[model samples]
Target: MTTTQKYAATGAWNEPEGATPRGTVALLPGRGETAASYARLGRRLAADGYRVRYVPVTLDDIADARAAVEELLADESLPAPRVLLGSDSGAALAGQFVAELPVDGAVLAAIALPGSAHGEVGADWADEVDARTACPVHRAVLATDEEFARGAIASPLPWETIAIGAQDRPTLALHGTDDRVTPLAPALEVYARAARTDVRLVQGGRHDVLNDVAHRSVAATIVLFLESLRLSPEAPPIVTGLG
Candidate 1:
């Protein structure tokens, strides 16, 4: 029987229906967002046959989110071979979380670049920009956004710290080539520094590439990355249905 649990930190989590629990994938949301934001992605994963959970971490709920993940893993009702899907700020946190836990793999999307706060390429600029502009100039303009600045302050995890710990884990970074907020160049640098050989850079996409036209490609890449782990058959199926 499939089970659904509501955690104090995370909002709601759903497992596979009428099947033996295989594994768990914790989906973390971006800054200023709730776990509910991942509902569409979760539904797609569920349709593909994997038990999925959306872990919400509000501005002041990082501790709660971490505790909830630990507790969920400890619960006998959950499955084994856990994987993490973290987007934006959540990706950084997920990296930190796994440093202490037994995680199988991780999918990091739209990750902030190292030293981005002080660098030219800061997080901002959701809109398109001229490709001719230098990366440093473009990044500085992107970082000037008030919303992005606020999210940076609110985020509990730092990209540099996460990148350091991600060295040992088999990580897959899904970044948008035209991502103004989290530019692809800096993100790629961080991924490279992590020594992760497997990284996917999607072109003509923005920070929210998961919902963009590149979603199908993103989903496919995610499946392939997870398969490489060879941990278990518990990971959710790739979302082939492109809405």
Candidate 2:
């Protein structure tokens, strides 16, 4: 409850007091995902002595996001190595960003990889949404979010990002065994193509693993992954442009 909160019209940032943060996480929300959607998860991560900056996604978010990531990397107050954390469609953006932006690492959760099918939602769209997240509270949160309600498709596209290839640093890919939105098979395929990827498939999890009932577990896994690279010395700056 002592977590410090900073807010903006489009996003929010969370940091823990007293504990020295090890690094910064430039978190990008997926299509239809809002910064508010990551509130609990951000606080959870902040509690672990890591700074979390939640950025809402816009149609042209990638370009603006690059600036954000770069700014995070430049911030003297926050520690390095810097990292990118993306969920669902945001993973697509993160994958692309990592290639052009020199960051320490990335955590892609419930990613919407290539060659995947969308989950069917009929008259029971509410139920379908419920099934997408294990957390009942998050179900309501998702339902209330204007962006989440809009149900936008993935933006900027991943075709170019995948073509650029993954970064030389650590990349963690997370998927749910039962994720129909993106599915597990294609997620594995995409991860396989990456240079250095650590993939994890959660049994019985849905597309919103980072915000699901087991979010704490997912958050913990990410913290551990980031911790592995916390002490890694900074690398050279990556050129920011289309490859």
Once fitted onto the true fold, the runs of candidate 1 whose alpha carbons sit more than 4 angstroms away are 1-16, 19-22, 58-64, 114-164, 231-243
lDDT of each: 0.59, 0.70
In angstroms, the error of model 1 at 25 is: 0.8
Candidate 2 local accuracy as lDDT?
0.70
- Writing each residue's lDDT as its tens digit, candidate 1 over 1-243 gives 132212313444454567555456777767655443444456555555456777656535667878877776676665655778888777777766766667777788876444543223234333232321224432443344333333342233433444535666677778777776666766776677665436778888666555455676787677566655554433343445676
lDDT of 1 at 191: 72
TM-score of each: 0.68, 0.82
Please give the clash total of every predicted structure, in order: 1, 0
Candidate 1 TM-score to native:
0.68
Put down candidate 2 lDDT per residue, 1-243, tens digits, no spaces. 333223323354545566777778889777667676887877778778888887555545457867766766676776677788988777877777777776778888877654334454343556557547878888877776665644453322434334314648788888888776776776777788887788887778888889777777788888878777864533322334575
Clash pairs (backbone) in predicted model 1: 124-181
Give the clash total for candidate 2: 0
Residue pairs in clash, model 2:
none
